[model samples]
Target: MKSQSTLLVICSAVMLALSGFSFFHRNKTATVSKKPVRVSSNYRIVIDKSHYELKLYDEEGWVSTYPVVFGTSEMTDKMMEGDRRTPEGHFKIIAKKLHPEWGHFLLLDYPTQTDLEKFNTRKSQGVIPANAKPGGGIGIHATRRNEDRFVDYYYNWTLGCISTKREYAKELYDLLPVGTEVTILH
Candidate 1:
């Protein structure tokens, strides 16, 4: 009877130790994941659509690169409203918003004069439909607030914006300000 009682106590102690280890391991993982990425330089921002990345650079050198997802029509440049295509060009960060749906948004000054001219030229050449309108309101942002679990794992899933992980967007937002140069490439 004493041996059986000792065995039961040993098993119980082992189970308690394992439970403590699991709790500590889970907390450690959560802390690591919650830590934000560090971004120092913010001179220029470049988005490569084909590679699905956003690279940051300073006058001195390249800073960091973050994986990014784009609009559904990833390969094509945005031409019209509701096209679900991201524009390709040199733009400036015009605004920033903490949207209710979109977690964090850094609005870009898309549809620049160059983009408008391209649209006009294409219209004159009959390459694009005459009624097609150049769209505006493009930006870089994170996933929808409620859909955080599936933000950074996708290929292309935005309407007309660049999408990154929520933590990444927060880091970039803290580093970048309005009027930052942003260049998008095919």
Candidate 2:
């Protein structure tokens, strides 16, 4: 009986030692790839459409993120004029305007070009007006005091620009500058 108990103890010790050795061996061999995360020199505007969140990233990680309302209707992609759908693509920030009188303005590069080939054959074209200019004024801006914030937060309500609360709008407009790169992703 004593010999059986001794054998069991020996077996347990051997198993534990084996486990410890294997674990250390695996960890020592594991090599973490040293690579730099690509970051742009310009400001980054990240729009996660699925999550309904807009994040601004600077030289550091995420600088700011505002919970946003998408669109009253499902916003998949933008079409012709008055489509009411916010565009999703890469754009360049050309201008920035602030209005204590109005709000804030962030001019964007719009008319990201949807099916230009089809337009020549088709009667209608998705043009941003020959004179109006494509990808113009768009930015975070303020809203009304008496307005229902819930609706804006719950649904998408901008002509094309991304609008936030007055304070947050100001924050973004102040932190980010013109010539920033903005990306709207699904």
Candidate 3:
């Protein structure tokens, strides 16, 4: 009877230890490297749609690169609403918010004056329907939790936003601030 009691205690302790380890492992955030480069106030971002990369830069130059996915496989400049294409041009981070599913979202100032002008030209030229509208609410954000494979596999599942892994989004959200310049290119 004493031996059975001892075995029960041992199993309980082992189960507790395993559960703790599993919790820690699941909650741990992955980093790009053992030591991440520090971001400065002069930081800027350049996203290359063709290359599926988001490169970070400071006044000093390139800091790091994060893998990213886009809204469409077309990889062209966004034409109209619901085109699923990511836009190309210079923009700025306008807002930051914590998202329930994607984790961190950095809203961009899309549909700038330049974008509007281009959109108008396209409409007049009949490249798009006269009634077509330019969409808004574009940004860079994280994939849903445990969905980092979307980025790794280049699945391109957003409506028009750029997406990275959850951890990378958190890193960017913590580092970048409003008014930071961002340039998206093909």
Best-fitting candidate, scored by TM-score: 3
Model 3 stretches astray by more than 4 angstroms:
1-36
Q: Candidate 1, 28: how far from true, in Å?
A: 26
* TM-score on alpha carbons, each prediction: 0.74, 0.60, 0.81
Model 3 lDDT-worst window of ten: 21-30
Give each model's clash number: 0, 7, 0
Model 2 residue 61 distance off true place after TM-score fit, in angstroms: 2.1
Q: Higher lDDT: candidate 1 or 3?
A: 3
Best by lDDT: 3
Ordered by TM-score, highest first, the candidates read: 3, 1, 2
TM for candidate 1 is: 0.74
Q: Encode model 3's per-residue lDDT on 1-186: one tens digit a residue.
A: 999999999998899678542211212233343235774799899999987888899888888888888888888999999998999999999999998877899999999999999999999999999999999999999998788977766777888999999889998999998999999999
Write down the lDDT of every candidate, Cα atoms only: 0.76, 0.57, 0.87
True-structure lDDT of candidate 3: 0.87
lDDT by residue for model 1 (1-23), tens: 99999999999889967854221
